[model samples]
Target chain A: MSGLEGLYQQIILDHSKARHGDGPLEHAAAEHHEYNPTCGDELTMRIRLDDAGERIEELAWQGDGCSISMASASALVDLMAGRTLEEAGERIDAFRAMLRSQGAGEPDEELLEDAIAFHGVSKYVMRVKCAMLSWVALEACLTEARATRG
Target chain B: MEGMSSDTLGARRVADLRLDFPVFRDAGEHAPAYLDSAATSQRPARVLDAEREYLEHHLAPVHRGASAAVGRSTTLFEDARATVARFVGAGERELVWAENATDALNIVALGMADASAGLGGAEASRFALHPGDELVVVEAEHHANLIPWQRLAARTGAVLRPVRVDARGLWGPAELAAVLSPRTRVVAFAEVSNVTGFLAPVAELVALVRERSPEALVVLDACQSVPHRPSDLAASGVDFAAFSGHKMLGPNGIGGLYGRAELLDALPPARTGGSTITRVTLEHAEFLPAPHRFEAGTQPVSQVVALAEAARYLDELGMAEVARHESALAARMAEAVAELPGVRLIGPPPGEERAGLVSVVVDDVHAHDVGQYLDEAGVVVRVGHHCAQPLHRALGVTATTRASAHVYTTEDEVDRFIDALGGVRRFFGVAGAGEQTGVVA
Candidate 1:
């Protein structure tokens, strides 16, 4: 497949059309907003921390963006929804490293799941931010949730 | 037959002129169709040669010392200024060198900021803003023109009042007149919009502003107009105007600001340093006249030489002919866009007068996807909000796909763009039978 086709697999197209966790969290611990100024894509991501303040109880978000950004956000919900905050942080770092690897890093497919569809996106330097936008929001929301965990 | 004959002549001229640009020569067999000239134009061989010649042989500090080399360099530099001033129909002393159009705009805003902070004394009071004074700008302004005015409003406590754009992302003299009052002190707008390619009636608007708000100063963002059309700044009667070199087939990092002599001399220099002052003491210094007062440090000398060559090249070709060539291209693109199944034209209608650009929002497909599909098919276009977020918001779209033409653009390139744009919805699996999918609709 061409790189553009690979970047827009059937799985990505499906997730983008019917994204998971595409709404606001009523009982949220923190909400973070991120914007991609290059194309005007924006998202407001919300997270609910567990009572122990070490785990994410739920995660939800609402925003408008392109297919790649929307699909990546849907895949992030599957990869990071119920994990501990520390675990989510590690995965976010690994995803960022893979994106920066210039298509050289061999990510663990079992761990990333549908997020692996973004492998073709790493080759194009401009679209790397589209895949990373959701993860960056997750990190910021988690940090804010942890800080204000009263 | 008369129309056909002139069309043939214009097409032949474009074909003959293509040889002057080196990029076309280097890409002989498989040249990508370039349609993003509104963002920047390709430099001709003459412009490139002039810069290289200056740097390789005749390089020295300008307006600095008494050395023979300095004198020669200064003469070349000042002669370049004279050439550029004549091209834009401005006095030589009224033109100031800037880093780019963005810097040229910032020079005005920053100078006003200093004036508002009580820096330029009684002479600079012309630029100082009172708390309730209003600054008028259009919603379709590029960020380069918009953000500086926003900041100026913030610093001076003046209210920023934007003349609203229509559904087509356009505002006419009527809309601007509606916003003017006795409290309006400044009016800033672009001569042609970067996104929608909407050409403003500059002389008409200036005349209206003078009649209504006599105290207001008109600042023009001429980045789009200077590169594509015949422009005489003094004849237009704008108080100040800014344009860049890179957008007009010249070297980057060099642009010019044209101001009336009175304003340039009265406005304090925002950036203070060596080469700007006439005399300096341990605690005080006095600045030189208009252009010298604005040019604060070591200048882009080679770039100035190349930019002058670019201006001369355009002058030799004749601005009226250049305008005719690009306007025809624009009309062709607009007609093609109108005929497409799902593409929506953003500027004035198909045959209406516009600068040399066409922007559109494709139905059921994001502009990024459209851009990618066009790139795959060897067509280049600008895809984004194009740094006009408020305009996009007003148009009810996040971004748009823009195809802009310059002197080097050919008919075949415009055809490629239209063909590739027609395929965007189908390629993205969004083509439906006569269904409107744009959010605004």
Candidate 2:
């Protein structure tokens, strides 16, 4: 009923149209790749880190997908970049909860903007799988990045 | 809506009758108008009640047990066999129960495999296929018919030649007979095409096969046809016929193969286990006769009982009346769809030749989108290629929407479908009836 405006919003569409959240960061950093076969969404995500890999210097991602997933990746890249591991983990948990709508507490106010666009998907059960496939793939990529350091 | 006294066939066809099934009656919001009859048919109250009656009162193991339950069950089981055989115009002795229609068809295939493999003992000559021999089937065959013969040909080094349908979903007597020569050892086909509802002239084709190649064995996939029409398998000259209970208002996991007793005896069982064997030695096992030999495992008893009831329900309404009635309904449905702007009848035109259903492609709309939109309107039709990929490829379309009718189907339902179909293009913002929709979701 609301047309595509509410679903797309300004920030998400800009990110999708520009593909700004793309490519690996230059210099030493943690990197990951994601794949969602259901809707043909694929992303190679990269995050630059300080010497010890405890703090994020830059975060970027490249992928092709529907408007929602690509926008979420771009927003995540922008919001989580320059944040420490502890803060990034909290943010990730909050994003996952918002998508699930079942976690113990709400995510903080700042990083919740892009994630709100997807709440409409929960009503359509079939679309939920399509929307979550990318996020799950991103989590897998992040887990792989953390494992590589050990 | 049912019984002989009823003015019309109503929604009594095998697949359409499923809506009367209590299970389907539970579609609270969006009922699935199941058009996938070739896959299975839903059971109506008559068939279900028949099953319940048998289970509640006539419960027992048939053929061997001596208790009152056993006697009553055997009567019910034997009575089912007679009813199914009679429905297809075969003698009761000639009909043999298998697991399902696929199993029924496989019994023929494996037996042919055996004869081709020289496993039929003294009677092996009746079925043996040598190198350079031909096994003729049609391109419209479901994988159930195709794969088995393909495997059989592979095993025996025989050629599998198909009497293929053209772009319009039709294969006639002259075209089919053209492929039959001295080399053709067998001719197999469906009495009706599951995808297109293209009715084949079984009697004429089988007669040609007999004339052209006297030794050619004929097998019929009655899975689609039997549920919709009255089939006289023996009279049609096919040596064997297969039909499933699920497709004919019975339970799933059960079916039958009607074979002339002499022919059945010649065919060795494909599966061997407890019941089918007479005596077992360390060296070899002597198997029981046909039907039981082919059964091999504990048969689907409850389903078989249910199938027997389905046959009786069909009998209560005369088969000839059933056929004629559904023919009119199918024709009406097809004609209504054809009249819709830009609706392309994928199969034969109405009255050209058909069983009791139609498949069509609408211009400018993807079938999936069409199906989704129709679901909103509470009209359920089968979307996508109806499993005959080769046939669909031949017809030059990726998918088509099929709406089939049975006895329970009303003329009003047909009109509603046609009316809603006209709106499908406009609702989806599709341009025209002849224009194509590319990149379907």
Q: Among these predicted structures, which one has the highest TM-score?
A: 1
Q: Can you give the lDDT of residue B323 in candidate 2? A: 69
**Reference interface contacts recovered per candidate:** 0.52, 0.00
lDDT (C-alpha, whole model) for all candidates: 0.87, 0.70
Cα deviation in Å at residue B74, candidate 1? 0.6
TM-score of each: 0.94, 0.74
> Which portions of model 1 miss their true places by more than 4 Å?
A49-57, A145-150, B1-12, B434-441
RMSD of each: 3.1, 7.5
Give candidate 1's TM-score.
0.94
- Model 2: residue A37 alpha-carbon error in angstroms: 15
TM-score of chain A of each: 0.93, 0.75
- TM-score, chain A only, candidate 2, equals 0.75
Pick by lDDT: which candidate is best?
1
